[model samples]
Target: MFAFAVGDSLVALDAVKIDTTDQARILRGGQHFQQTCLSCHSLVDFVNDPVAKELGLSKEQMPVWPEDSWNGHPPPDLSLIALSMSPDWLFTYLRTYYVDKARPTGYNNLVYPNTNMPNPFVDMQGHQVLINPNYFDKNHAHGEQFWYRVIKLKETGRLSPAEFDDYVDDIVQFLTYVSDPSVHARRQIGPWVLGYLTLFIMVTYAYFRLVGKDYFQSPKSPPPH
Candidate 1:
């Protein structure tokens, strides 16, 4: 369980960074996510198919990845992965896939060490290896901060470093949207629902003042007998 630091050059992602709202990026991310992640992790909501119309992607363009036959135990469901794990975690995790030839998949994560998973986008982002891991003192760093802060790429891959970051960002954005497809509609309908409730309360109060109690007073108990 390695913790990430703010100024660490190896994992340069910010914990407080915001997710991108660009529709194009988000849509592209949905494509990549379907291509890579869905192969292992099943999205629980795909049976209803909210992703296509909501994200402006078609079923053909973003078909779900075929069921994985590579591993015996199925990977964890990813329906809420983005929500449970923040966008920064997802982004940083996606980008910091350093090479470790000893592992079965030949890759280990910077954020989560000794991980069993492989880098799905290895060709696009390339491979990296740890550099200085000297900050191992108890008082130096703890909790969410690790001593290591650098990694050097051993081999270059298809996409340049900058392009890979942008690609990962787009995927993160799509995952954030996938967590809650109804968020946009909810926001849109929220104001109207509030307005209707307010109007109902005002109308009910007006009715009470005008004729509600006066017309039904039980004749004041027959003038107190």
Candidate 2:
């Protein structure tokens, strides 16, 4: 299994490509969410969120998990997370969690240090760790090492590497869409708003012409009272 841990001086967050319009991917991610992530993270602002409807989801179809039982700490709400973080940040963060002995969650992330969050899909992604951090790179910098990685799978799970990448992309897309659910509503109404403005401009132009007609015609002065 080949996996990449993105961080360090050489890794660029912009390199990860994700398409938000892939409806199938987004839906798959939603399903994955139900099965995995919902058990930890809560989408508390979901009451006003409109993206679910846009994604063809119903409230009844969704289930809210109890607060996370891990370490007695409740997981953070995911409502505005995508809005706060960059896509590349999300991309790197999701894929970078590796097994760590010191952490209570038994995992650490290259992007986020000492994070308590455990990788729920670890079985599917297998395990990943950084490559030789001390390899000499005179061409770059003396103290810094480029992000190289090696992923070894002791056991296989449901998804393959490519499928897992798509899964991550969709999850990011869904979360991003959820961040500002009103954007979908705006997108839907944008064309109608523009059409209304177009018609209004034409009507206003005609009205202006009518108002100007008296200016072109003979002027009439009223008699002094």
Candidate 3:
């Protein structure tokens, strides 16, 4: 399991670091998700997330999705996605969608081939095409490494490349926060916890020094007696 997870994380090294603490950005992501993903994907755990509540996000505001499935493919709940799949993996997967008419969804992903989830950011991210669609066999025998080299943006989208990246990053950050709602409280208290430990250690050391001199030190020689 460790190696399997690590292999997934190594899929893309270019993934940008996410700042989950940015409440404003997380809010933007949450709103965008409500508009786009919530129509199909449900975040059951996130509905009761304290951080999400503080951000004024409510599941009641989301559109009701079918209880059965989405086109025979039940959309997976994404509440724990950022934990099950690394943020880097999610970020890369979202950014690496390429046009594939062969698929029913008219899209495919580099990280996950033949993904059931449609390209949610197509309008903002624009169309990406494989530079060499024929280089590999129909079976995709060449694997993921080749896919990384072949995908290229064919048309500019509403958002510039950089803007699109930031947009995706925000969404990924929001997911990450949802995975571990306690993160905000932990980060906020971490510094104070360390400070308290440091102070305790220092006081303990001072007391040790003050008492050790009398307890451990040899008595002064009695004037050469």
Q: Which has the greatest lDDT?
A: 3
For residues 1-225, could you state the per-residue lDDT of candidate 3 as single tens digits? 122343432134455577867888878888777777787777777777666676566767554556465665567778899889788778888888888989999998777766778999888989999887774455443234633577888998999999998888888888888888788888889999999999999999999899977987798768975
Which stretch of 10 consecutive residues in model 3 shows the poorest summed lDDT?
1-10
Candidate 1, residue 17: how far the Cα is off, in Å: 4.0
lDDT of 2 by residue, 133-220 (tens): 3322325442133233332344455788778777787788777767766666677899999999999999988987999688667777
Which residue window of length 10 is worst by lDDT in model 1? 1-10
- lDDT value for model 1: 0.64
* TM-score comparison, 2 vs 3, better candidate: 3
lDDT of each structure? Answer: 0.64, 0.63, 0.76
Candidate 1 lDDT over residue span 95-212, tens digit each: 7777777678898776655556678877887777766444223233322443135566767789887787777887787778778767755766899999999999999999988897
For model 2, state the Cα shift of residue 225 in Å. 33
Residue pairs in clash, model 1: none
Model 2 global lDDT (CA atoms, 0 to 1): 0.63
Clashes of each: 0, 0, 0
What are the runs in model 3 whose C-alpha is more than 4 Å off? 1-13, 61-68, 138-148, 189-225
